[model samples]
Each structure stands twice: as structure tokens, then as C-alpha cells.
Target: MIELLQDAHFWVGVALVIFLGILGYAGVHKIAWKLLGERGLKVQAQLDEAGKLRAEAEALLVQIKAQREAAEKQAALMLETAKEDAIRLGAEAKVKLDEQIKRRAALAERKIATAQAQAEADVKAAAADLATQAAETVLAARIAGAKSDPLIDAAVKTLAQRLQ
Candidate 1:
């Protein structure tokens, strides 16, 4: 072995092979394993964080859903209240309108009654005026022209008796 190492080419070849083996071990085994191990730990931590974030997101989603449901219920109640209020207002308006119409009708009926009474009084007045005029004319004719016509005189006497 000493004799073989004493040859320069043989020692150089051995040193080259040992150096390449050390280089391969450093590049492919020790340094690579350490780096890969660290990378794997980092990936696992990230996965755990992702799971926690997913849970938080789910909780937030549930809260949002509950809020939306509550809002919808409130909206429905508000809509129902509005409808009830509208109905009440409409009924009140109808009642008021009916009262106004009744008032108008009553006024019209009162006017009609007043007109009827006035017409009746007018008829009575006209009749009375005609009767008085006829009486005056007969009295004048008798006083002015009473020389003859006993029938006219008797008729006039009967009318005076009836009038009295």
C-alpha cells in the first residue's frame, strides 16, 4: 500500500474520489435533509393556521346568518305593522267620508223641506188674494149699478152670507 501511494497518479486519484464522495454527501444528504425538514415543519404550521382560520370563518358565517334572519323578521314585522296602519287609516277615512256625505244629504233634505213649505204658503196666499179681489169687484158693481137685476142682487146677497 505504501508503494502504491508513493506513485503520484495513484494518490491523486484516491484524493479526487474522497473529495467527490464528501461533496455528494454534503449536497444530497445532510444539508438537503435539514432544509427539507425545516420546510416540512413550516408547511405543517401553515396547515394548522389554515384550519383555525376556517373555524373562525365558519363562526363568523353563522353569526352573519343569524343577523340576517333577525333582520328579515324585523322587516316582516314592520311591513305587517304598516299594513295594519294603512287599513286603519283607510277605514277612518271611509267613516269620515260617510259622515260628510250624510251631512250633505241632510242639508239637501232640509232645503227641500223649506222649499215645499214656501210653495204651500205661496199657494195659500194666491188663493186668498183671488177671493178678496172677487169680493171687492162684486161689492163695487152692486153699489154702482143697482137699478135692475134682482137675480144679481140675490146672488150677491147669497155670496155675502157665505162669506160671513
Candidate 2:
């Protein structure tokens, strides 16, 4: 028993036991356990908040994707509508241009007819003037060659007036 009391290892064991008993009497272990539990609860709450934020982010991403798809569809529809309108307008323009060309051709034909009519009238007037001059020249020659009776002179004057 004296040897055991003198052993260094036994003294150390005794000292450790006494220190543990003091800590228990002072409630230090309970305080340490409570602090650890509180730390654990804080970490769990942080994890829950992170999970909620992640879920919200995922939902927002999905909603944004849906909106983008809708916008793309709308854009495509607008493009198609624009293309159809362009085709329709192009056809309309072509039709109008064709109509204008036909109108111009008809107008040209009318102008040509009017010009031909004017030319014909001018040619007839010129022919009539030439015939009148020829008749006047022949009558003058006849008058110079022969003495004219009053009755013959009257007839010639009437004929000249009629020719003119």
C-alpha cells in the first residue's frame, strides 16, 4: 500500500479524478454540452436557410426559362407575319405595276391614232390646194388664148368660185 502511494502513475490518476469531480460540481460539463448543442442548432438553421434559398433559385430559373421560351415563340411568330406581309405587298406591287404598264400602252395607242388622223387631214388639205392651183393655171391659159364672151365669162367665174 505504501508502494502504491509512492507511485507517480497512481498520483496522476488521483489528481485527474479530483479535477473531474471539481468540474462536475461546478456544472462546467453541462455548460460545455449546452454550448455545443446551441452551436449544432445554429449550424442546422443555417443549412435549412441555404436549402430554402437553393429551392427558390431553382424555381426562379425554371420560370425564367419558360418566359424566354414564350418570348422566342412570339418573336418567331412576328417574323413569320412580317414575311407573309412582305410577300403580299410584293404581289400587290407587281399587280399595280402591270396595270400601269397596260395603261401606258393604251395611252400610247390613242396618241398614235390622234396623230394619224391629224396627218390624214393635213394631206387632204394639201391635195385640195394643189388641185385648185392647177385649175386656176389652166383657166388663165385658156383666157389668154381666146376672147371671152360675157356669158362664158360668167360661167368661168362661177366655176372658179366653186373650185375654190
Candidate 3:
């Protein structure tokens, strides 16, 4: 037994036992366990924060999607309205153009009619002048020798009666 007690291996075993007894007496294991539990709690809190952020992100995504859909609908409506307006404006312009063309055509016809009437009046005046000159020549040839204050007086009396 003394030989075993004198062994270096036996003394190392005793030293190890004493060291473990000191650590247990001081409750070092409990302190270590407490620190590990606090670290775990911190990790849990971080995980909860991450979960909250994920939920917020998801909600934001949903809101953005809704907004995008609404914007698309509004854009489509605006486009439709613009197309309708364009069509209406085009129709109005066409109507106005047609009216203007008709007005212009009527004005042109009026001018042509006026010109024709004036031309006819001018032709009639020229024909009357020509007839008067022809009659004067015929009368002058027929009455070349016969002058006649009597004939002139008779013509004056007839013109006066016609005027009355």
C-alpha cells in the first residue's frame, strides 16, 4: 500500500480530485450554466427581433403589391379616357372641317351667281346700246333727204305720252 501511495500516478490522481473538489465548493459549474443560459436568452431575443422584421417586410410587400395594382388600374383608365378623348376630338374636327368646306362651297356658289348676273346685265346693256346705234343708223339712212322738225316733234310727243 505504501508502494502504491508513493506512486507518482497516485499523487496526480489525488491532485486532480482536490482541484475538482475546489471547483465544486465554489459553485463554478452553476456560474457557467447561468452564463450559458443568459447567452441563450440573448439569442432568443435576436431571433424574435428577426421574426418581427420578417413580418414587417412581408406586410410591406403586400402593401406595395396592392399599390402597384391600383396604379395599373388607374393607368389603364387614363389611357382609355385619352383614347376616347382623341376619338371625340377627331370627330369634332372632322365635323368642323366638313362644315367649313360646305360654307366655302356655298360662298363660292354665291360669288359665281353674282358674277353671272353681273355679266348678264353687262351683256344686256351692250345689246341695248348696239340696237340703239343700229336703229339710229337705219333711221338716218331712211331719212337722209327728209329732215323734219315735224318728225322730231312727233317723236317727242310719243315719248312724253309713254312716260306719263
Candidate achieving the largest TM-score: 3
lDDT of 3 by residue, 2-44 (tens): 9999999999999999999999999998998999999999999
Give the least accurate 10-residue stretch of model 1, judged by summed lDDT. Answer: 155-164
Q: Where does candidate 1 clash, by residue pair? A: none
Give the TM-scores of the predictions, in the order they appear.
0.61, 0.75, 0.76
- The reply for model 2, stretches above 4 Å from the true place, is 1-14, 139-164
Assess the local accuracy of residue 6 in candidate 2 as a C-alpha lDDT between 0 and 100: 100
Please write out the lDDT profile of model 2 over residues 17-131, one tens digit for every residue. 9999999999999999999999999999999999999999999999999999999999999999999999999999999999999999999999999999999988988888788
**Where does candidate 3 clash, by residue pair?**
none
Worst 10 residues of 2 by lDDT: 155-164
Put down candidate 1 lDDT per residue, 30-71, tens digits, no spaces. Answer: 778889999999999999999999999999999999999999
Candidate 3 or 1, higher TM-score: 3
RMSD for all candidates, in order, please.
8.3, 3.4, 4.2
